[model samples]
Target: MNKKYNIMLLLLLIIISPISYTYNNDFIIRTSVDMKYAFCDVKTNGVSGANNRSSVSRGGIGFGSTSTNSMILMENGENTITIELASLNWFSQDDIPQKERNIFHPNARCEIVVNKMDDQGNIIPLTQLMVKINEDGQPEAYENNKIDSSIEKKIILASNTEKIESDKILERVNAKEYPKDMTVFQFNKKINISDLPKWPWVEADKYEDTPKQRELLQAAYLELWTAFEQQDDSKIKQLLTPSLEVWAASTGGNVEEQFASREIGESFSKQNFQMIPINWNNFQPLIMNNGKMVKLVYKEDFDFSPVSYRFTTEKGTSRVAYHSPIFSFVNGKFIPVI
Candidate 1:
């Protein structure tokens, strides 16, 4: 066999081999509000698992659907792996609050099947390794069996690994191969507001920003940054209106901060500005221009624009000054009006 074939064959055997493991729901599903995606991380064995390991495989559970499709295969032989739900981030239509993105609710159970695959794609399950987290990045394990106040407190205070060891994994077995043709066991539980973290951004719901508004902001935020990074003037123009485009071109400002510029396109091309997505939670809503428009003031951490050739010359500068970009809500979309 050729080198390519040999490599492929080796991988298939190592990941496809089937092995049975005791099903244990030792971990709780934790939701991260800070992430741009609806992300769930796995923690077990006193170790917080990462979602991008080679041993972890991921797939989605559709509504009324009996089987799930496996999209990724992780490294073999590891006892734990984390599966990130890339597809389950807040849907534009789902209307989930932007601040509550980290909260797991009963409205929909985002089921992710993590398969431990051997070289040949055979499988073993490590459900006990699956734990859900609250907004605090802490695990919320199931405590249905015990009602003691102290036990509850202990369970609450117990380390992620400790809480897992004492828990039992309820098996939801199907004859079909999991990930390839797995059965839907259960959806994630809806966490109470009192159970979530006390983050300041969690209160963003008090404002008039609707879920659609936030979703638009998310799309616009990503689009704006991508355009800025690629220096795609046409896309930037498309994202903003004629009035706003002129303003952006004439006035300099980073999405995170504000400043002055003569030509936005020329400034970037000359300085080779690089835009990166760092934080999205550092934003607030404000009414600007005497109620003619609403502005979303994302904190300075949302993205930072810096010169790509800073090493070559100290003269290179970004478009932004000290103030952040103000996205105006116009015609149902956020544009670079400010």
Candidate 2:
């Protein structure tokens, strides 16, 4: 009987060993940056996360900064990592003086730290990486004034060791997955905005929705939707803020020297917007930024791809999600702020 009991215990250990290791293998990424005005995007193994953006500000308007954390799953092998940092003040060239812009100057610094949690829940630091604009010439880093300063590093993470490309030993770290049998809905067909049903509004304790506010907000949304369906760049521009325009241009590679030259409509077309569908039922009105802006968000978990937007692609399946270009209610009109 004692021999049988010992054999049962050994079988249990064999079944549980792999599960315990897999549960604790994930790495946590903490990113922080200090600058007058800045934005940072960090990615692990081609998956983007830990993104943080500060409000655009001028001299009297004050400074901008960000600090955020994300968790990354690893495969016990070499992993690709990338970081992009941009000075927000550089985009506000018209409002901010050139001397004050300080694009990629020595004063600004961004840092990324990787850590892992043990079975006992204690945080163990693996490694830390820092990027100073002054260090743009580093072998693993590069700078593009038109886009943003970026760094690419490869790391081999295993059960016993963490190794980075530069021979440094240290720590660390979805594109959301779509369903296999998802139905693809074509968005090319035009639908009258008035015929759509009213989407429910998400209640915010701090903000109240009045009839007049609702009317103006709905009107703005309809106008933008109409412009999007018609592919009218001029109309879209009238509704979007100058700051957002600058951001669009910065993200769109070396397309044009000036932001005005990059047509937003053409960019949308290149992204295969026709494959996406406009599902009114999935949208919810969300008041944000101290009630200054109204953003349409997905009611379910607020992801770029909410299951309903999945579509077929050459690579198998993809999701086309819409969330941003949050509208600010100003001067009795709704304008896209970000």
Q: Which candidate leads in lDDT?
A: 2
Which lDDT tens digits does candidate 2 get at residues 1-338? 00000111000000001111112122233334333323444444333344443233222222434543323212233433445455445444265555544444355444555554443667765544454454552212323333223333422211111122431111111101111121211101111111111111111122346767666655655665566566666554444434332232322222132235434444354434442344445455665434644555443323221112222344544334332444555434554433
- Residue pairs that clash (backbone atoms under 3 angstroms), model 2: 126-170, 126-171, 127-171
Error of 1 at 141 (Å): 61
Query: On residues 85-199, what C-alpha lDDT tens digit does candidate 1 reach at each position?
Result: 3223222224445554344333322233343333354664424222234445433333333221221111211111111122112112111111221111112221121111121
TM-score versus the correct structure, for each prediction: 0.28, 0.34
Model 2 residue runs over 4 Å out of place are: 1-207, 244-272, 275-281, 304-312
TM-score of 2: 0.34
Model 1 misplacement above 4 A = 1-207, 244-262, 270-272, 289-292, 298-325
Say which candidate scores most in TM-score: 2
Q: lDDT of candidate 2 vs native?
A: 0.35
